[model samples]
Target: MAARIEIEGDRCIGAAQCVLSADKLFDQDEDGFVVVLNGEPDGEDLEDARTAAMICPSQSITVVED
Candidate 1:
């Protein structure tokens, strides 16, 4: 399935769970805010995005199906 990855920077607490859970799809800026490395992840990468969304303490990560 295809999905879109979204990150809410204002809601992020810089916990880095997204980065830890899905490094290929997500990263952190210099200030440690969540960054989307690949907003449109597919295959196993889609799973990574889902994991990141699940583990985000601040609920900053979102995976919307397209």
Candidate 2:
């Protein structure tokens, strides 16, 4: 199954771990909060997405199974 990304904006603390782990699927807004770049990415991207969620400092990154 592919993974889908979800971010809780209020919980984000401008940490870039998500962006650094999976830049193709995550980015930061002007306020430095997380922004979902690709909601659903398959294959290796899915793995990276999970990594992003794991490394997130604020625990705002959620990788949903699809």
Clashes of each: 0, 0
Q: How does model 1 score by TM-score?
A: 0.95
- List TM-scores for all candidates, in order: 0.95, 0.92
For candidate 1, write residues 1-66 as lDDT tens digits: 779998778999999988888889888899989889899999999998898899899998889997
> Poorest 10 consecutive residues of model 2 by lDDT?
1-10
* Candidate 1, residue 2: how far the Cα is off, in Å: 2.2
* lDDT of candidates 1 onward, in order: 0.90, 0.88
User: Which pairs of residues collide in candidate 1?
Assistant: none
Deviation (Å) of 66 in candidate 2 = 3.3
**Top of the candidates by TM-score:** 1
| lDDT value, candidate 1, whole model | 0.90
For candidate 2, report its TM-score: 0.92
Report the backbone clash tally of model 2.
0
